[model samples]
Target: MTKPIYIHGSGCVSVQPTFEAGYFFDHVTSYTQNPVPALDPDYKAFIPALQLRRMNKSMRMAIFASRMAMQQAGITTVDAIITGSGLGCLRDSERFVEALRTDEGSLLNPTPFIQSTHNMAAAALALSLGCKGYNMTYVNNANSFESALLDAMIYLTEHPAATILLGGVDELGERTTQFWDLANYLKRDDATIPTPLIEQATPGEIATEGATFFVASQEPGDHTFGKIRAVETRLEVDAPEIFISGFLQRNGIEAETLDAVVLGYNGDSRYDEIYRTLGSSLFANLPQIAFKHVVGEYDTVVAAALFLALGIFQRQHVPQRLLLNHSSIPPILRRILIYTQRRGQNHSVILVEK
Candidate 1:
């Protein structure tokens, strides 16, 4: 059996004020625009002004969130660092491409190119924390975060005494956003947060960006938030219900025993049916929660879902705004199953418990 991976701490920076003290999803910040930028936190509190000015949004968010996680875990450093980003340092990437295009033969600034790689966030975290242990980054579209999470679990199983920093970060790119728009991947009409769901759902997703990090270890501590029982991902699942059921059964858990479930309903009419079907059938009687509406949709947004799950475990109360069904809420929250997919692909299931 794999060793229990306990979450000692978590931090998130998203479209909502997730970095704010004492803020859960109780009151969410809404957006009327697509491709929304994450709410910025005061970076000076967590990073040096010189370093902050040199980093892109993704690096800044990643470093800040990781620091928050470290602070909550009461540790200045970790043994390893692992992160996932679907699009890495997007703004810097855009800058490099734009500069290269404009200044063909001239010497160009190399900072953007240096910071534009997908692994730079992990590198930045390692440098900031002085961690020289294992470091890795995954970039598999929507499955990116899950890949990192699964790796963390396996790493803990092999190195039971090791503590690792695991998370995901993604930022919006200007030209890329336009490309997504051209490809009909972004919701043009009615692109608003608190995004309309189910029958009222529209087409495409509300593109946004954010970062979420966690401090994980195999040993449960006095302050440990909860444990991740299992995590699984599929490139494409013909039937999400079957995939989810199999994952739960493998973990020796039944659908009916769950305290609540976090479902990814991003208000995309084309694919929200997947979640709708699961809700009305498998999760009909459970307290179903929706988060993408509040945080908006991004490749690594599911990292925020895991953050929300941990928050729920900590608070023991489900915010009314996140509730998606009329089912009887569990009196004592405990086990929660989070399932999410993007455009009917990259389906993932995460089972978490207190």
Candidate 2:
């Protein structure tokens, strides 16, 4: 049997207030028409001025979140640093692309080019911590975070890495946001009616970006969020039935024992049925919750879900904003199942328990 991976500490930076405030998600923010940027955190608090000048937005966010997680974990070094990003350093990528276009591929600065790599953020974090351990980054679209998580699980089996740092980071770019809007991948501004993702539903989807970091350890600590029981991903699979059953069997979790189920319902009618199948059949009576309504849909949304799960474990209370059903079980939530997918591909199931 593999060692249980415990989330010793976690940190997140998103459109909603996450870093400073403990619980401020009373009112869910809606962007009925456009993609919104994540709320910026005070980088100076977690990062120094000299370092901040050399870092891009994604790098800064990753570093800050990682530092916060490490502080909460009460540890100085980690055995490995792993991260995932759908689009790493969008700001830097935009700058480099524009320079290549306007300057006809000439007079381009090497700074943006260097930072545009997907692993730059992870590299920066490792450098800042002076950590010379295993470092890796995943960029497999929606499965990016899950990929990193699965690797972390495998690494802990043989490496004896007491503490590991894992994270997912992404940023919204101007042109990409514009393209999404043009393709109707974004919700339109209409306060009188709910967005399509919540109602009409279509192939187009909402766009948002943020990052979440966690310090995972083999030994459980006082502040441990929960144990990552198992994680599985598939590129192609039948709808809800096979997916849920496979995950539960692999992890030895029966449907009836699940304490809570978190679904990635982004209001998109196109794929909401996938989650609905689980919600109605397998998790009908359990406390079901959703977060895309609050954080918006991005490749790394699962990272946000992980943060929310940890928060639920810490508070022992489900935020009313995330509740999808009225059924209230015992306040102590022990097991949580997080299900997420993008465009009917990259299906992932992450099981966590106290």
Candidate 3:
């Protein structure tokens, strides 16, 4: 039998003021341009000056978020550290490329080169916390974060006493922004687009970056946010409703049991329909919530969504900004089903329960 995993704590660093104490997107952040960068937190609070001086944006965010998660979980160390990212260390990669161009591929700075690897965040976290156990990082596309979640779940199942630090980190890059703009993956700066998602939307999404971490264990605690009932990912699904039914069936849950759904609608017209179709049909009676409009789209943005889900469970209320459609409020917030996709691929379904 597969063991259940429970989330004890979560931390998120995003475009909004998520790092602040008791902040929950109460005030939304806006952007005049596309592919916005995440707001910088006070790195000194988490990392010392000597170490902070050498870290890039993504590393700092990941480390700080991990620290916050550990603090909330009341843990000095974890048995493992698992992270996922699409572009890895984009800022470091850019620095490396720039150095190559300026120096004619000679006199390379080893700092950026060393930190540019995809597993650097996990490795760094492991080193910082002195955790030598199962450290891994998933570099899959949009499903990278979920891939990390899968590994954590399996690890927790076999090691019941183990607590794992799981997270996803992705940062905006100069070259990445430019390339995405060229590929029409970014909303036009000239156009005013309403966010979470726009029913009447243009071709692109609000591209942004962030880092979020959570502490997961096989046992629940007083501070636990909820239990992750199941996680499923599909490369391609012919019918979303049928696919979701199979997923819930595998987990022995009925559609009516879901209290809410955190849908990843990034305001990209090309893919918003994917959520719209499912929302109006299979999950018609369920409260539908979304975050990508506010957080924007990134391979790891769903990491932030997990944080939001924890907030929903803790608060037992849905933020007005995240509610896409009106549904009768459930007596209690118990189960939440999350669905995310990128360009209609790497589709993922995750279930969380209080």
Candidate 4:
């Protein structure tokens, strides 16, 4: 059996004021743009101005969020750093590509090129923390965060004495957003935060960017937010409910036992039905919650869901903005199951408990 990995602390940087001290999902920051950008925290507080200027959005957010997690965990450094990104340093990548085309293969600026790789965020964390231990970055599309999380669990099980920083970071690119617009992957009309879900669902996602990080170890701490019981991801699932059931069975739990559930209802009509069906059948009696509408959708946005789960564990309350069902809130919130998918693919389920 996989051991539960304890989350000592977590931090997030998203469309909402997730970096704020007491910020939960209660007062979400709404956006009218389709591809909303993440709210920029005072980077000067966490990063040196000179170094911060040289970093791209991914590196900046990753380092800042990881630092927040470490601070909350009361640690100066971690033994290892592992992260995931669906699209790494996208802005830098776009810059490099544009430079290549504009310069006609001539010598080009190397800063963007050097920072464009998928592993740069993890590398940046390692450098910033002086961590020379195991470092990895997963780039498996929307499953990136789950992949990194599963690896973190395995690493902790093998190295019980080690503490690690695990997280996911992704940034928006100008050209990339334009491409998504052309591909009809983004909502152009009625694109607003607190996205109208289910009844007022739209056809495309509201693309955005952000990062979330956690300090984790094999042993539980007094200040531990929660424990990740299990995480599973499937590239394609014919029936999401069945896939979720199988995962729950493997973990020896059932839907009825869960205190609350987090569903990825991003307001896309074509794919929201998967969640709607599950809500009507399996999760009808539970407090169903959501986050993507406020944070917007990104390959690694599910990391924000995990952050929200930890927050729920701490507060033992479900904010009204996130609540999607009429079910009464459980007196004691524990054991939250988070299920998310992008366009009916990369379906993932994470079982969390306080």
Which prediction has the highest TM-score against the true structure?
A: 4
Per-prediction TM-score: 0.98, 0.94, 0.97, 0.99
Across 124-200, the per-residue lDDT of candidate 4 in tens digits comes to 89988889999999999999999999999999989999999999999999999999999999898789997999999
lDDT for each residue of candidate 1 in 177-230, tens digit (9 for 90 to 100)? 999999998999789988999889988999999999999999999889999988
Relative to the true structure, how large is the alpha-carbon lDDT of every model?
0.92, 0.82, 0.87, 0.93
Query: Which is better, 2 or 3, measured by lDDT?
Result: 3
Instruction: Judging by lDDT, tell me the better candidate of 1 and 3.
Output: 1
Task: Kindly give the stretch of ten consecutive residues in candidate 3 with the minimal lDDT sum.
Answer: 190-199
Point out where model 2 deviates above 4 Å. Answer: 27-33, 191-203
Error of 2 at 242 (Å): 1.3
lDDT of 2 by residue, 251-342 (tens): 77788888898888877667887887777788888899888777877888899999888888888888887788877766688989999887
Q: Which stretches of candidate 1 lie over 4 Å from their true place?
A: none
lDDT of 3 by residue, 1-354 (tens): 667799998889998889999998777877777767888888898889999888888889899999999899898889989899999998899889899999998889888989998888887788788999999999999999999999888888899999899999998888878898898877885433237355566688777788999999999998899888788898888898899999999988889989999998887788889889998899989999988878888999888988998898899988888888889778789889999999999999999888
Report how far off residue 174 is in candidate 3 (Å). Answer: 0.2
Query: What number of clashing residue pairs does each candidate have, in the order they appear?
Result: 0, 8, 1, 0
